[model samples]
Target: MATEYLSEKHLRGFDKYKYNAKDTSPLSIYVMHPFWNSVVKIFPDWFAPNLMTFLGFLILVLSFILLSLADWSYYASSRTYPQHPPVSNLVFLIIGVGLFVAHTLDGIDGKQARRTNSSSPLGELFDHGSDSVISCLLPIGVYSIFGRDEKDYGANILLLYLIVCVISATFYISHWEKYLTGVMFLPWAYDFSQLALVVIYIITSIFGYEIWKGTYAFGFEFRYLFVLTTMGGSVVLSLPNTIWNIYVSYRDGTGKNRSFFHAVEPAIPAVLLFVVASLWAFLSPTDILQLEPRIFCLTVGIIMSNICCHLIISQMTETRAKCFNWLLVPLMIVATLSVSTNLGSLELYLLYCLAAVALILHFHYACSVVVQLADHFNIYVFSLEKRSPKAARVSNGTK
Candidate 1:
């Protein structure tokens, strides 16, 4: 088989086979319309064997993140909105299921790419870009839908979500590029962090005052210390990805003069604030606890700080390359800020518009590549297959 040189520019036009080369080649597996094939090609069977395995690792990482985040949020919401209908817990369940579904679909696209042999640079560009956007937006959207009316509270939740996502993605990307090169990166240690948080949440939900009674196991309250531990641990554990990213960036001559150690934000203060909030809550009676505006207010502040941290980190790394990962932050902020105050309607028009634009652009670049490849090969090989001297020369050499 003759090997062809594929350039970065040709990614949008790589789907065609030889004009009259018969159906003997593997490329024929993708003979359908370039546009449709590219769209369908993002499944498991399309991925090369190696890529499929890597995709599995990513799916697991994503699953762990989903499970931990869901558990923590559910525990918090249970106490934070104790008066809301039991139906609210359904939202957390739905998010958990959604994560699983999204991860499964994510696994398929790579396989499709491999099975059809339609893998191209632009397809990759779209896939990674989509994941980045979804990672930052979905959580924020959920928070807005459920907690938007809580004034700065909802806004804060969305902000922190944005921050963690930005830092995590940036670091993961930088780390993967540095360590794995051709393989997808996995943050295995991150699972431990999530596990730790789940434990903290369980303790907080059950005990309430053990953390701030200042006697270790003496007063043994579950209070706000629980929220602090979970949130603080989340931020602290998130350091691995960020630190790895910074290390990679600096080693790659990209970090310039940025201080590595200085980048570690003071998680202590935030953790302490959470402790104070928890103590206040613990001292209050069960009934009053439900009405405390501070419960929602402080939660929002923590979330907002998280978001701000991510934005700042993203902006700092703007000129360092691969800056598109930050695109969701501003868009998410805009959407959250623009929603109706009552949350009566879903108002998904903006979401729909964004999804459509991304899809159109993703497929447009892919289809153009495949179609162009078909055109080029059709003229080059099929037109003069028997007549061209070079064809005979190449054919003879093969034998």
Candidate 2:
């Protein structure tokens, strides 16, 4: 089945695909976009857009892995646990530099594609596909900054789960909205969020993570203000705007204009993702979330990224979206076994197994899709060149 990830139906849809997006973000319009327009010029025309996309993702992963290793329990900076030894000030600097470079590369890939005359649906897919993973990783890394104490500063384990879900949902829905409406309603909050996080990481690098602790106004911790703003941007700004854009598209007869049920079909998998992860965390006999927050977050984020990838494929190719995601079945079984059956260490092992499976499936899917598309499109995914004519002829004959 993995070999057939893209069927004839999907290929046919891709043949007709054209990228369309609406980005009215003041930041993107007046600031980042212009900066990217200039920054992209520095690159040689030989630079591949997909290379930038993939490299940026790798940089972010490097920073995330290094930070996780340094702050495994995510309390290295905790005032309440001084013996935990604060994350080296250098880690924050690494993350800050890494994120800034990654974010900049992301902003310019599309512009680079357009400049090099290499624009295609494949580039968008690669860009946002990596983006889906970054969506989860960015927040999980930020959680380490605030640390895991609800009263002193950082959010507890449960709240962090919700934050990851909310951020992932906002991103997934934006793409899903495109599936329904045929227009990507780019969120203004995205640019601000990335820049803000970079600034925060930089601030921590200079002044230490302790700056976030105990600062208060109107009887609430300042860290909670970040939490409220993050969640609020999703529930208040991003989602409502997405719904409105979809509604307008349908009302004006510009969208796919399917029935309500069909329009909402893509949401089932996304909803189930949150449900399965929540059940596992909330019902775990071992208190998996609190006892093993890092693994839990990584597991859930990988699963969420896989789901988002499926959604992107559906939207980009105009293929019928899945009403039920396949990963949910196995994940649900894992959750059930962890909670309903007594397995002691095996439960944590099950969680490990889940993360492993999730990671494997995600990579397999990403790699297969990229190879398939590269062959079909007669292009290199990370190089500014076309495939050999012989290979292209063979690819077209079969696929």
Segments in model 2 whose C-alpha atoms lie over 4 Å from true places: 393-399
| Highest TM-score model number | 2
- Which residues of candidate 1, in runs, are more than 4 Å off? 1-90, 141-184, 189-399
lDDT tens digits, residue span 1-399, model 2: 235478877877788998898898888999998899999999999999999999999999998899989888977867888778899888899899899999999999999999999998789889998999999988888888888866568777787888888999899888998989998889878988999989999999999988888767787775678889889977787878887998898889999988888888988888888887898888888899998888888888888888889888988888888888777777899898888988889888888888888898888988888878777788888898766767563343453
Listed in order, each prediction's TM-score against the native is: 0.36, 0.97
Whole-model lDDT, candidate 1? Answer: 0.36
List per-prediction Cα lDDT, in the order shown.
Answer: 0.36, 0.86
lDDT of 2: 0.86
TM-score for model 2? Answer: 0.97
Q: Using alpha carbons, what is the TM-score of model 1?
A: 0.36
